[model samples]
Target: MQCSYFDAGLCRSCTLLDTPYAEQLTSKQARVEELLDAHSPEWLSPIASPEQGFRNKAKMVVGGTAAAPTLGILDGRGEGVDIRGCALHLAPIHDALPVLARFITLTGLQPYDVPSRRGDLKYVLVTANAEGELLVRFVVRSEDVVSRLRRHLAALQETLPNAVVVTANLLPEHKAVTEGEREIVLTSRDRLTMTLAGMRLELRPQSFFQTNTPVADQLYTQARTWVDELGPASVWDLYCGVGGFALACAAPGRAVLGVETSVDAVLSARATARREGLDDVRFEAGDATEAALQAQPGEHPDVVIVNPPRRGIGETLARWLDASGVQHVVYSSCNPVTLVRDLEWMPGFRMRRARALDMFPHTTHLEVVTLLERVDSPATDRPRVRMP
Candidate 1:
């Protein structure tokens, strides 16, 4: 898992690259346990990910001149440090990066110069699905370079046949953002299919999907196993990006509803449900907190699945879930600090079981999923437990 970029100090994204992979996983699991030891829940063995060639997505900052473009992150001087062969990216992404760099040259798409803010292209975002299909996006300052990209799209596709979905995202501002509001499809196909845990999840241009394919599969499979064991009749997936958790939990008689703020993501989720013939599963585009608060009188779910961003659902949603009368909650969080804060908000619930999934290998970040059971009722009440 050696990275020349890390050694040369050109890119230090993987801060723990010096540490052994096994040690990294162990330290991450230990840190999570130390943070959640108060809950005293049963701890499942931590899931491990490959130290290298595991990242399915490559977010390379477009730099250098368009004629000789660099595909990687910007340096301290805001110039691109070429990492086309970064070890973290999957094979497809690693192979396609140089081709994409050439495409930039062919189209004469100027790399956005951060210091001067004079160029057109900002970033090249490439994603690879489990089937080896690719979705390529070019984030630019405006539509000024759209014509060039569209005109040469066929040649680029012919060279990179695996590129199924190609789009140009217009980020007109000079701000430091990944993408913008308007996404123009350069190819006939608009969505890329990610088959995870036996679910054909459609991915729109702006849709969210886990970067680590194998680890993401393990996460969904673990959640599905938990839901099956619990056998909840109805489940609500909050902040459901592309309905991964919701679709994973859907069953014969089970009703699953997924709520997300992104309309594109909601549309992708619904399409997946329809393609799978999941009549009982539905998706809505709205704020998760508002959707939860506006649930009909008899629409309370038996189980709720929340996979929030690093913020960990915030206090408002946490407090609402605390009093929602939901029997159980499956909480997946990427930040243990925020997760502990949210857990403190739900004093009436007890963490029954928890597991750590090393989705971001060679880094301090980790993903943890916990089963929270409402133990306020006498029938379900149990003494606080401790892990020996």
Candidate 2:
């Protein structure tokens, strides 16, 4: 997709924008195939993403005046760079940005000045699902603006009809984080539901959900398919964001436990489970590494699924999982560098199949999912199918 921002040299977030979309996917697939050669020969073609208008979430740093606030990235010298109609954001996010801009004027709120640090508004974060339902959060200096925003909440919500949830986050100190410690929900409903593969996954403002909603569904579906083939009696999902994988893989007799650090994500996951009548799956709030090591005797997982951060599972967790009795491991990684590092720790496990999902089309980012089986397991003895 052509972007005026790129033409004007205003934003180069999509570094690969100059390259053709087809070649971009090929490059991503080639990178993974080179790095994970011995790990998994069986492969699936990279699930390509749209050239533009695919991002489900839009985080625009609040800059300039509230009346004429800029919503985009900060410049090198810490100045607001306005990129309102960024092609990467989905239609709902693009449509709500102007409404949010207008709301700032109606509320008479002042956008924070990065240099003076005097204004109240700090950011405008908007997340949308496939159905175009939106969750809008205004990040501000403190709770002082919360009261003012509450008065104008109705008008804002009315202007942006798709906005199902609205919230305010406070950041008292000067920092790099876009969000703050305290979150105040301005709307009655705080959770947004994303329906994928016949399952509803609820996500809060603070919960982690993929920016590319369609590609995320494909990612979850492929992982669930692999888990179904293995048919493990008990499964553990580490860093389970809103229990997408855990809930999708939940079977009649199987028990699925999802461990995540975010209380909000775990709560949303639990609520969705109750709402969907999936009692076999449960989500808990805790550090994934600690939770994995602390599983009770009867609660041992037959298999473990890990979707670690870009750093991948650190040395400690990787070494622990290497010796853990879990027979199979499914790892979903956004960074191949860290993925290779973690793979070095797993001596007994061998990668069975690997696939790259092109979640970010015009960027270098790629999501690679791999299925691993213990060396001595009967499953590993089967001849691995070769990839094209």
Candidate 3:
């Protein structure tokens, strides 16, 4: 779990690297309980993540020269730190980093210089699944290097045969963003398949997937277990990125609808649904709040699963859910501070059970999933089990 980058102060992304792994998990569990203990809900044991080689994705900034490109974060001076050997990345990602760096040289693609803003490539994004297949993306300033990338892609693929998907993303602006609107496919394959809990999840280039693949599976499995215990006939997954939770909860008779804003993600989700022959499960590209607010009483689901951003669900959606009178809600949040704020809006619902998942280890970040029930719902109330 030791990171040379952290010890040398080259990269402090893992702020808690100095602390022991046991202490990190203990601190995270203590913090989450302090935030939610007032609700007096049953607490499940916190899920711990692997200490090293867990991240499935690497968003390395392209810096330095084309002859010797650096694949890592930029220093305060806007120069690359060359952290290709970062311990957080999975084996496939670590192996592909050197190949990608070599590809930059072979393609003669200039790495973007932050202060000067006079280069073609900005970032090299690489994502790998459990199967060892990879999706490589080069974020460039323009289409100026598209021809070079396409021409030498075969040469790069020779070294990294597991690179099934390759793409180029244009970020024409002089801003600090990672990608742009236009994307060009460099390989025949356009999607990467990530298998979790006996289900295959396809991911388009822009589709969002968890960086920690193993921990993500645990997260989805926990959600599925809770949903099965509740046995809701109909469920709505808001902000459903690639339909991970929605697909996980899908049953023969259950109707699951996933709402997401990204069309690519929706397409990926739909493809997976078709492959699995889950006709009752569906996905649509739309805003979560709008879809929730537009749902009529008859269209209301028996359960609503919300995996909102760090901002939580916001007051508007929170207030709507408060008055919607839904029987149950499964809320997954990365920020408990915002989660507590959203809980304040839903006074009609009470937390039944909650668990913290350590999605991001070596840092203060964590994910908490809470099952909420309407205060006056007809379901029989079970006594809350105390946690150790």
User: TM-scores of all models?
Assistant: 0.96, 0.95, 0.96
Which of 2 and 3 is ahead in lDDT? 3
Listed per candidate, the RMSD to the true structure in angstroms reads 4.7, 4.8, 4.8
lDDT, candidate 1, at 5: 84
User: What are the lDDT scores of the predictions, listed in order?
Assistant: 0.90, 0.86, 0.90
Measured on C-alpha atoms, candidate 3 has an lDDT of 0.90
Give the TM-score comparing model 3 with the true structure, all chains together. Answer: 0.96
Screening candidate 3 with a backbone cut-off below 3 angstroms (N, C-alpha, C), the clashing residue pairs are none
Candidate 1 at 88: error in angstroms? Answer: 1.1
In angstroms, how far off is 162's CA in candidate 2? 1.9
Per-residue lDDT for 1-91 in model 2, tens only?
7899998999999999999999999999998899998775599778988888888899998777767878888888778899999988989
**RMSD of candidate 2 to true structure, Å:** 4.8
Clashes of 3: 0
* lDDT string, candidate 1, 269-355, tens digits: 999999989999999889988987776533467789999999989888888877766788999999989999999999989999999
> Deviation in angstroms for 33 in model 1?
0.4
Instruction: State the TM-score for model 2.
Output: 0.95
Residue 355 lDDT (model 2): 90
